[model samples]
Target: MRRARLTFGAFGAVTSIGGFVVALIAACGDDRGGFIQNERAFETEHEGGAPDAETCFLQCSLDGRSIIDSCTGGVVETCADDLACGAAKCQEPCAAAEADRSSNGCDFYFAMPRHYAPSIVSCFATFVVNASNKPATVSLELQGGELDVSRALFRAVPNSTDLEPLEGPIPPGESAILFVADWDPAKPRSVGERVDHTSCPTEAKPALEADFGNFRSGIGDAFRLKSNVPVGVTWMYPYGGAGTHYPTATLVLPVSAWAKEHVVVNGWEATLQGIPVTQIFAAEDDTEVTIIGTKTVSNGDGFTGAAAGIPAKMMLSKGQFAQIAQTEELTGSSVLSNKPTATVGGHECANVPTSAGACDTLAQQIPAFEQWGSEYVGVGYRPRTKNSDEIVWYRMVGGRDGTELEYDPVKPPAAPITLSAGELVLFSARSNDAFVVRSRDAEHPFYLGMHMSGGAGRPPKVPAYGGTGDPEFVNVVPTGQYMSSYSFYADSTFSEHSLVIVRKKTHGDFKDVWLECAGNLPDWKPIDNAGQYEYGRVDLSRQFGPGDSFGDKRCTTGLQRMRSEGAFSATLWGWGAYASYAYPGGMAFRKLVETPLTPVN
Candidate 1:
């Protein structure tokens, strides 16, 4: 995580109609002729694929002039001579023919969350997408519990599995679905036939299954994916209780973005009949993790518990995950790790009060406090039913005891609420309403967790979309953390796809934002504002272009890119009647800034 700082100096220039330009004549006239010659030579030698015409011109003019002024009477030399002398002056260094390539090691740690209930279900699946250009040889190691792991690789056209071992190398752009716990092969076969492969294929495709299995689920269960090339990881709760319960899934963040310290658990709604649990994992072995929670609790399965009034410290080796189940709503609890650690927070199963729908689990990996923001805009899927209301839980962490926070659209808008570190406040509205939140002081940044309801449901209606109205847990990335561009993969099965965009309201009423789907741009709509923040929603499903799909498939599983001229953060929300999930639109690594590297416990 490195922050780059750039400084620019002003240069006055005079231009003629013929395009001739002059500036700083008094200071630059002495060696102007030599400068022009040196500049031309430098450009001829090093201007291979200039970044831009303006940059090239500026470099040639400023750097050439500086060199001439410094090296008066120096003879002009060719690029070859400059290379030998190593004295070529230019705005940018010459491009290297064989530039050093940074190594993105194959080692990756994935934090797996507990399914509906470890005791009731043991089935869990992990999908790995090899997004890199080169093939990847991957190995899996499970921690915290012993569960049989099965792997199946899927490739495009002829979708054959090369008689090679399941642990064999995965071709570039291909994907492998690993089923852990008790899985019934019959279920996958029932949904789609599996073809035997003579060799690994080149293209990639998505695999659908009816029921993977009903095996034992474990808390703090984790797996390490060591690959020769960089890959993307996604965890799937396929179908809990074999379709009796709604399914949910999330995109896994790379380990490089993991942080050493986090304001642990986010908002928990115990009123929803579901229990809130948080799973934490360490990336390195012998990692010391200190847990401070709201109350004392007992450890279940491979999880460790902490006592109230006194923080509990535990040592976790690499790949180890700890599940902390809290009976009471847990917010503001802190988890400080000596080594980088990852965390997932949400309920095993929950229902939004007053929102119609059966309880479904909602969980999201909690971003570290270092990524906390002072501003956020709340958004959600359309209401499942007209009677059902949408709710956004605003949990603030890292603030003083009396830190005041404000919100919009709540009416004479009750007075600002005072919250201390780890405290939470709630706001409710129609599913279509948008709202904004900001802290009184930007210096004291705070984090926000947005929980959207699965919506009110009617039996047999299935809500049109899958998960019909499954609850969604998305950790809102702050506006300050937004990136200008992003590339990501959408869930292949999700029937509805929408992107929630939030921009600083102060930036003006409108800013150009584009969603490039399979190379086509689509129009997006703006929503009514709350305060200090503007909102926009893009329906990717409805905007898919001709090439956005395959043969008959309208939405294929592939990379989708987005860009914005102004600062803004976006979250991709996808759901069907059966389940729903949301993830930040941009890569987490892009938001990272260089910080202290802490040692393991």
Candidate 2:
């Protein structure tokens, strides 16, 4: 959608009439009289007989802007983007075009990090999970890199402990894990060498300026996964089993979800050298990205320079990407691009709680700023300790200024708080605790994310932050964007894996939600006393425990399926001795606004 405005003649503007100018700022500058939306009919002349999605959206935006232009207008800009709540009511299809961006897509871009890996270890995979009825055929290709390399790629069969080598395409309900690179391969592999991708490489070796282009797939190069069927994508780095792992993972949304703009977010602050990083990768050629709300970042490609809080631009070709890493957290940075592009935010390996001893890699493909939601139910992850609360970290990024935020049940101390555009609030949520976060209305959208800090730090150990798992990151799926069904996969490298589900209790078939292998969900508890939403957890790892492996083992590898009449959201989280990973089940990646799709994930 084009940037919209709601200028008013009488609201905070000086209109000159026959050499007589009247000052309205002092008389009408009291913040627009509470931002009320009154829908009125307007005749929109379209070329064809009826309005389609584009025409419908155009008319709706214009109708909203027209209404606000007649009102006090100083504060009613949020409604100009959508017809749903912005002064104009649109049809279901038109709203879907604007609101229902999901995860199904044909092309995806990913570049595993050169984490703060002090030592070397085997990196398990970057997975592509198929959710479609038809089989998913994929190609894991890299720019300027050899094809059909001697890599570790396997088709994971859900429900069973089967990691089948992928010589053929992914089955209808299966996923493939491609080991692109290992941290410390048996031997050093060159850019042209036929070996797997890199694990977390130490920043010293190859150095950020040089070796990154060789292996990091950033600035100069990138890895693109082209697929025949829409599939869900995720990546886990250095996923060694048990005590040998220190990992982080993120769910990759489809190209359809990519927008021309984004807001950057990252984990806690760390040492000057280990701060968070924001990545910008192109979906097509001739793409240009402009950044704002950021600190000075050394130009990765040397094509342009970046300065603090000033708009900076970067140009890219088809298979290229760039990064902006800083000691200062890169949260709230604005990303604007001419072509639809993907923006990923997180840390290569940073301290979770700002100065925590152990650090781990964090990565999550961020959603477009406009795709953010106003309501979310945050269900906590597995407790890091037995009989104790898990301290999960959550951050909220305001999409608009003057956002009045609230919480249900036990209102937080910071409840009824207000945030300006690009502002953020960070807080901790305990294990087994759930919070219903929201703003007053849909016009005040915000983004919420969950971060996991490793259990009590263990010093003198190889990977010190070694309690349950190192810091992990994943975006919280909004209740408004929930899906009725999901097909996903969990890496078996972890000692334990679980799914945290949040469902609207008001749904007619709330009790009909079903997990294929686990049968009906066992525990169902309300998130708050309002009883509007409920939370539950299913231990996928325990279901396949030592002795019970053969029981549900046939269908648990990469195609675990769940369905319900009412839409619901689920997060996949798994952890090893000191390693962990998490991401949303899946979402439909519909084109946002005038965004277009290029035929095919």
Candidate 3:
């Protein structure tokens, strides 16, 4: 429901400031001060010449004082000697004064003079009056609409003359800032998303969850409206991405029992409102409140409270919104503190250090003997291998002779590490830190190992928690879930060949950690039994595959075809996360080595 009002002027000058209407006198027909009629009849009546006294009104200065001269809309009539009354007297309020239609339930209507002399500027001064005298508090907003401020311009002020107003009131004569733009009524605005405020009183706070799967990724949650009152909330989504838009968004929350509140659906930030820092309990539970603006005002109903009007506009969106599935609200605290409250195995197998001592020691071996349920453990390792070493090494566990040791299913609990399937453990003897080990099966006994660079007082810190590095053949009894493992760092400086021993109560097997300098080789051929090896070798070769490939596919194709004839095929899987060696030639996989192998000096 809108209407347009028109005013006439001399040359066509009009300047409107907020609610105040300040029309210039120069725009009037004859350069006389008067309101212009928005009617076609007024123009027809005054088209020919100046209007008579009955049609127009004029004011002038007589003796340094304002005086009403005449109503002719033309020149003032000179009085004759008989009717000479010099003192000014008005028969009624001057037509110019009465033309103010701001009050008395009347529309202003006045006709301008036909013409005026070339020397007078036209101007009209209008003011806003405190009609009810109700403290004269008027919020001079730009759009005649409420805007959210907390997340944007969070405050309002008017202290001294240099007041910078984001939004506030203008004293009496001053008009609010008026910003107008050409708007077509035919244009349709996009339909806003729906919001539900069902859990009003008890949970006045609306929880915001970001949905990244929609056309425009944004935040949303549902709430229960306690009463038919306006509601608004502010949400801050992590900014900066291809799909991000404005810094905020503002929308209206309808009066409903249960409403889904979706903020910033269009990707605009300015359009967003509500408190920025909301208190969330545990991890995913967000705080809800009814009153957004005022401090103390609630509906007082159980699970349904209503506060005073919120200071901002509430922006909500509909379905098909943004979302990230298969993830939980993991607040910062939950990531750092691993609180071990529950245990599934025979013992309280939680937070047990994966240090070699925890796994290697015979006394602490009971925990490793227990079984495991579905769980995950994080293990950080420290490597000290040299850059010049040709082989990138990993710490190894149970594998005896031709048979790989069976992991315990129940006893000797296991805590496994959560490394991506094929991610390799790059060896770097740079740090002096202990690493943890966990098994997927809880019953597998845990073992610890140590790495050291044989300095004076620094005999590498043997993972004493599990056991010391024992290069000598030591028979180990099958205890809990875990079996025996090489508890010492494989010395790169030793005979260049480490010895591996399989110790059992009744049977035993032993092999050189490497192809010994001069010794009886096992019946297993190095090349043929490579798959049964304790470790595998990685080489530099181009990485290429079926549809998508890298490197010189044409050149590598001949070698790939040659290798295809062998018992092995080229690896399509990408290399490890971190680089073990600089293979600018790309990634290539060779045969796995069962026992320790020697490096060609």
- Comparing 1 and 3 by lDDT, which wins? 1
Query: After best superposition, candidate 3 residue 283: deviation in angstroms?
Result: 29
Task: For candidate 1, give the lDDT.
Answer: 0.46
Q: Pick the candidate with the highest TM-score.
A: 2
lDDT of 2 at 91: 26
lDDT of 2 by residue, 31-134 (tens): 10111123211222211121221211221221122223222223233332222221132222223222324564567777766544433334545667664334
Per-model TM-score on C-alpha atoms = 0.63, 0.73, 0.14
Question: What lDDT, from 0 to 1, does candidate 2 have?
Answer: 0.56
Question: How many pairs collide in each candidate, listed in order?
Answer: 25, 26, 112
**Candidate 2 to truth, TM:** 0.73
Q: Candidate 1, residues 1-601: lDDT per residue as tens digits?
A: 1222321211111111122111101011110111121122211111112122122111112111222211222334222312111112221111110010001224556543444443223335555655334455666666534333334443221122122325456664455555533333344332222221111111211122222221222244366766655455666664222233445566565565576777665435664555777777787878888777656655555445657545677777777777666566556677788888877777767765424466677677776666555545566655434465544434445433545555544321332456666655554544456665555544345666566554454344223222454666767665444433343445445555666666543123344555544222333444323233456555555322222343343333334544443445667766655566667754322222233212111
